[model samples]
Target: MTTTTELSELTGDYVLDSAHTRIGFVAGAAMVTKVRGQFDEFEGSAHLDGDDPSQSSAQLTIQAKSIQTRNQRRDDHLRSKVFLDVDNRPTISFISIGVEQVDETNFKGTGDLTIRGVTKQVTVDFELTGTENDPQGRFRVGFHGKATINRKDWGVSWGRGLVSEKVTLEFDVAAIRQP
Candidate 1:
């Protein structure tokens, strides 16, 4: 277990442990059920300023072609020009513009999120889950965050009445501290 002081002392650079982290989304389908999908390939880094949270920053890049939703047909369609247009805009990215610590275990991050060549501001609220040292002897930190966005804002206006406009982005992140 890590104490509050220990967490504050953990000021350093870290990389997302992609194998243990999940970047997923949920969107309403046909105004009834919901569709869930996740990106299989992504990389991210963060510079944490525990003592001065405002100085912290993070960036992430996700492969657009890696979108998976259990159904190959739907996945392939998502990558087509009608939706993400993965061939032309192969990656989605985010870069933090500001960060604020709401309390001991909460934080809010505002950043520019680019999807399908469209860039927009997004704010994600995060909760610190915990910290631990894995068997590999690496320091790891966990956080869960989410944000709601409109697909049409990014020009993903294909299945209008079929697919809901609002999509919720979810993140279950595990970051390992660098040496």
Candidate 2:
């Protein structure tokens, strides 16, 4: 467990550990079941000003064509123009506009999320899971967050009645501090 003072000592620049992080989403399907998927390729970085949490920031870029949903046909459909349109818009991105510490272990980040060439402001509530020194002697921090947004907001309105418009985005991030 990391204390508040320990968190302040974690201030630094960090690179997301893509191998240990997961960017996933869940959406209702056919109004009866749910569909879960994830993007396999992405890179992100963050600057943590633990002493002044307001100054903390992060940015991420995800390859749109890397979307995986267990089913190849569904994945192909998502890459089509009706959805992500990977050919024209090859990536999805996010840049934090503001960050606020809500408590010792919770934070709220507001950012511009771009998908399918459309940008919209979204807020995600994150909880600091912990911090640890890996076996390789690298210092790492963990955070998990979730945000709900309407698919149509980003022009991803292919399946209407077949798929619920509400989508829940989830993040399980582990960042390693840079030397």
Candidate 3:
């Protein structure tokens, strides 16, 4: 006789492939200047237990000094004392404790995000885009997550009136399953 195992047993560790992922932010200013940047160095992973969604966990680490706003001059100023101060605080991270499902592919997760040595509770919304087999016969799952954060909340209050107060955070990630 054939038996079925619980969904929770499907949980597995996923290695983040940076080549297929990106973490970025966008903000507008004066209805003309749209500021955008991304972290070039980061590592993230997700542990998902399908049977028991509660068993899922996720974490992300970003290098503060890797932030690039496109303009070298502005990037340098942002790294100065008035801003990120990368020399003193070089890492930003988020660790999730639990996940809440809003729909089949949509879910919200509560976690702690640390930046510039400051930590705060943040909510990340993620969507599952199903899984597929690669040409090598390896299984892979994809997901996209987004969150909004206040730069000042994490002690990054270097923005002037010209810069917006809210920053839109986004992430695109893919994990390949190995047999």
lDDT of each model, Cα atoms only? 0.94, 0.93, 0.79
Q: TM-score of every model?
A: 0.97, 0.97, 0.88
lDDT of 2 at 156: 85
> In model 3, which runs have C-alpha deviations exceeding 4 angstroms?
1-10
lDDT of 2 by residue, 58-145 (tens): 9999999999999999999989999999999999999999999999889999999999889999999999998888899988999999
| lDDT, candidate 2, at 119 | 96
lDDT of 3 by residue, 62-111 (tens): 99888888889988987787777889988889999889878666778889
- Return the number of clashes found in candidate 2: 0
lDDT of 1 by residue, 1-179 (tens): 46344557668999999999999999999899999999999999999899899999999999999999999999999999999999999999999999999988889999999999999999999888888888999998888999999999999999979999999999999999999
For model 2, which pairs clash? none
